[model samples]
Target: MPTFNVKLPMILSLLLIFLALYVLALRGHFSYVAMRAGNYRFSKIESFNSLALNPLMSFSFALRDYQKDTLDLKPANMERLEELSKIFPLFSTTPKNDFALKNPPHIMVNLMESFGTQMLSLQEGNLNLLGELAQHFEEDFVWTRFLPCQNGTASSFFCLFFQSPIVLSKSKYKEHYLPFIPIEVYKQQGYRVIFLTAGNSTWSDLGFFMKAQGADEIIDEVALLQDYPNSSKIHFHSHYGVGDEFMYQKALELLSSAKEPLLILTLSVSNHPPYPEVPILFSKEQIPLEIFDKIPKNTSAILNTYVYANNEFARFLSKVKQSELKDKLIIAATGDHRVRGVAMDFNTEKALAYGVPFYLYVPKAYQGEIVYDKTRIGSHKDIFPTLYALTLSETRFLHLGGRNLLETQENDKFAFGFNAEVWIDNEGIYPRSSNLGYKYKDNQSLLSTEESFALDEEHLEFHKIYQEFLELQLRYKLLNLAQ
Candidate 1:
């Protein structure tokens, strides 16, 4: 009744105008969100969705255009194509290294959850809750900082095992079935490949993926429950299933009965929250109440649970030391990703979250030949190639695209972050979607926005090659070649 005085055509025109303005506003907001959020999701959506109606998609497109303005390297050239082919060669045809060791040591990879090295130290009361484990690694093993391929647990596992970037787009993931994973490689080389994890493998489709990759045995949390239905020790954490101790116990049982050379991939849990109320290891009550009281409640709870898990690990290691399997095992330890907290800034937290400690331990027999360089920067992609180099018959390239950290220098090294969206090198962090990046020298320090626009052709080439390599790998996978 109030609008009866307005003309019908005039009202329709006003409505259309308002709709257009609303769409424009939404587009602007979406652009801002894409730019702020680092465009990981934007990249995924853009990969397949040509009709991306969301304004955020438009914003992501704009940001990417700005980021890639100067870099126009194409993979279509014949010479570049050939180079990429060599860099990411056919998996089956890739020449195997011959280390010539009569007895290749049994390899064990313990991929720990939320195991960032940001506050980790040897001191008590700080994040160095794993002081004993850190000390053991420093004194006995090859210890260095390694970045994860991505932030999530599944992504980290995919990067480590598949030796490739973990692309989560529906189209990309479905098309690319990587076969260069360590499980397949170990199985091919006559090593019994066993996957042990405290979480649900089905959570990430890795249960089926790992099976397809030729895991001889896949023991996940579901299997644990089925095997130990009456055990009181089996309890689930919110994110990580069951517990670390249970997984370790099961691993030990497998180790004792293992008849062949084993490649046991053990993934630990209990580091995730809601924190478990496990018994304290040391006399924390001895510490001054003032010290404990001053800390934030959330921080205190996280640290307490963390220390408890560390204590459990120490106990597990002690058991390993006393067991006959100690000498036969080549233990490789690393965190899946950095810890996430509300206090942390997501952008700056990249360094903290991705920069996890990597420890490679060879018995005295092989330690002499292996160089334990603590300075080199590496990634999860290097896990298999390093293991291959350590115990193989000869020293040849695995062609997994990761450098053998033992042989590569820190200055020339870099790592890919989650779907190759970001590149971390010695100089700084470069976002693939935007030219804008953060430059930092130290892992703990905050990365400042890089003002200079100088593009390192080497880094650019490396990034292009990596991206093209994945694309070609997917094509090869679809054709069922070199898989």
Candidate 2:
């Protein structure tokens, strides 16, 4: 190749322009990702603008006030909401019955082992992707934000499936379906549903809650390993026992026997932890235990396992292409939650503890690829509702608590709270406060009042509605709320 003459001035000009643009983009990215969230808006636009510059401080302040919101609840409502929030895992509501259905448009994700970092890995030219890029997804799948439920894998899994937040804070291996999840409502409309965790059904007390919410059939490691007697491989890890991968292969088989439009979920355990003796991708020998042992205490093991899980996601994505159900499968791949012990040092301006990443990938229908946007505000709570909105028709789904991810707005607005965080982008609001801007896409003024009383009142009402949602969920046992 012949070298072209390069002018010093031209090179300098290009460099300057590139530098400027990069700086601008970085500023925008950081700003959007760092917005403050809590029970109350900022004292003033000036306060928010000043602190918002430092996202870490803003998020800390926000978290500090989470207890404040609960405290602010009227004694009666607080008691009512608390009672409704506890007991069954089905934790929320909106009064509507028999929501419409799109037949098999319901979704199920089989997390055959995943790590939070994989979603952030694109540095190696898609070499780490589980599946080849969905051509349409490459251009259109714009990432909106992070979802809140990243503490555990199961939390992220069920949260998105139900289109609402899964109450992991209650410290049980189980959670319930809130009425806000369109998928549960679809089941009310006569759709078939089943959740299969290839590990212990008791993983996280999920077995009890999964049933409370009305999963017709539930199978844990015992069933696959000895109880029901199906072919499965044994895997023994502190966190995940045998039959993790077995669940994947068997879930696929179940799909083969399923009627049209059925929703079947199969989760994995190998990537969960204590990963021992799994084969390396290219190495001939098995992964030596020493490598894992040599990791620097907690971080080293988590990192190694996370890397292994990332590769698994890439493998799963790639494997789907080679299968028959590619078209019918709308896989919502994401982390249940970032392993907090591993992410102990992580902090963000917009809810630092919420490092869980939720990515909704529909093989053929996905309009773009690389759904991760480093600067968007998102949470685990956003996963389920968005997943439902994406799979089913938008009109029917629009009413749900979670917004359609395809419509990720630009205003940097997220509905974030203890177990809930939802964002909608692309809207204009006066620089000062959160208006009704969130209640509806166009109704910015609906919430725009300088009055603290109305803010308090509306907030309480919203809280009440959310409580009612969970209460209804418990009553109906929708989305496995039975426990």
Candidate 3:
């Protein structure tokens, strides 16, 4: 019997060897193995291979125990914090003026899914993508040069909420109480923070994270269905949950009955993929044949969802404007990241790939002498700083990173932006993985990389300091969590 089981033992031995190699590759001990392993996605695999690889994914989390040894970095972190404080001040005191309201306005941040400028740039006379939202964009403040902190939805959401770029994988935010959390800041100022989403909050443990970050209420797909039984369901993309209109309708309901100042963060999922069936309210646009041929195969499906999302948002705004909350609300909307299906040459079109629109609609009552510069380059980090400046008065909030885009001068040295893969400033966009950066003009459409366009010493120094600052901020958070 033992001799007959030789093949079983051989297979077990090979499986053990493969697992060992996978662990090594995940740790990046072998360059070739690491390169190959980096491309592995368990979602794409449809066999026993996913099960085998699943356990190994937790290997990265195991390394977090080693990172707890960063207590020694405290002094260095303190020095960096001091240096950064001088550059980016923590407290934002609202100016004493007539524009300052007697009470803080309700802050509404709508995170539209895949609302990229690259696709919007394709909107010509015949090809209308914006739909009803076009009129609002022309009237309100829309910044085209803005980028998201990360390319993925979850990463960008966390980046904006925490006001930091360092997002730990599989880490429970409940364990770590970061000082830079925007929800906590809003809570401290007596504002009720509500996180509304059209998708399941349990998708990335986002519900738990939002609760830990001081969100007063979380309205997800389950909550929406419980409240409104007749709400629309996502027929095609059931995983994405209800349509955008239902989620926005819930927000309007909350605003109508709110007693306290509110900070409602709405995440719309209708614009995601595999695209949901277009709602009845969506008006289909005619895409030009010339531009149609250049896009991905599912361009029609993508545009339908995009235009639907825009129409829903515009409808939401119109309702808000008609309500009594019109003069008492501050709405800021932006995309989580660029649309995924569009192809871009990374060597030249990196900015276009990362570019998303930042649309701000400040109430006339709250509009001080603030200069609105649509050409300024920024990312998700700057969103809260601008919001804090407008909403809070003389409140001391932690400035983890980013400047107040409204008050920051054009020549401000700290006016640079750091997306996940690139560093953006007045000069151009610099990809972190590459030595050479590209120079652009007219809102990053035209690119040039001449011999004189190399990253200078000053740029290198800024990058070095910024990278270290991010690491220190993360280390400090970990140290706080350990305590």
What C-alpha lDDT do the candidate models reach, one value each? 0.58, 0.44, 0.71
| Candidate topping lDDT | 3
Most TM-score-accurate candidate = 3
The TM-scores, one per candidate, come to 0.68, 0.53, 0.79
- Every candidate's CA RMSD: 12.8, 23.0, 9.4
**lDDT tens digits, residue span 1-483, model 2:** 999899999999999999998665434323112222311121223354354345555456546545444411111334553454443223323222122233344356654355343233322442233332333235323242443442456555555554433343223223434443444655754656677765665444555566666767776655555533433332333335553445555565666567755566666666555554454342313334443332334444444445555554445555655676665666665555544433222111122233344445465543222233434444444555555544543334322234334443432323432234322232211111233322222231111122222234534344345535543443343323333
**Residue 142, candidate 1: C-alpha displacement in angstroms:** 4.7
Distance from true location, Cα of 214 in model 3, Å = 1.4
Using lDDT, rank the candidates from best to worst: 3, 1, 2
Looking at model 2, residue 165 earns an lDDT score of 35
- Point out where model 3 deviates above 4 Å: 1-76, 83-101, 232-237, 279-286, 408-411, 443-452
Per-residue alpha-carbon lDDT of candidate 1 for residues 167-199, written as tens digits (9 for 90 to 100)? 332122433445545666677677998888876
Off by more than 4 A, model 1? 1-81, 85-100, 121-127, 142-144, 167-177, 226-240, 280-297, 345-350, 395-397, 408-422, 429-453, 460-465, 478-483
**Could you tell me how far off, in angstroms, the CA of residue 392 lies in candidate 1 after the best superposition?**
1.0
Q: Rank by TM-score, highest first.
A: 3, 1, 2
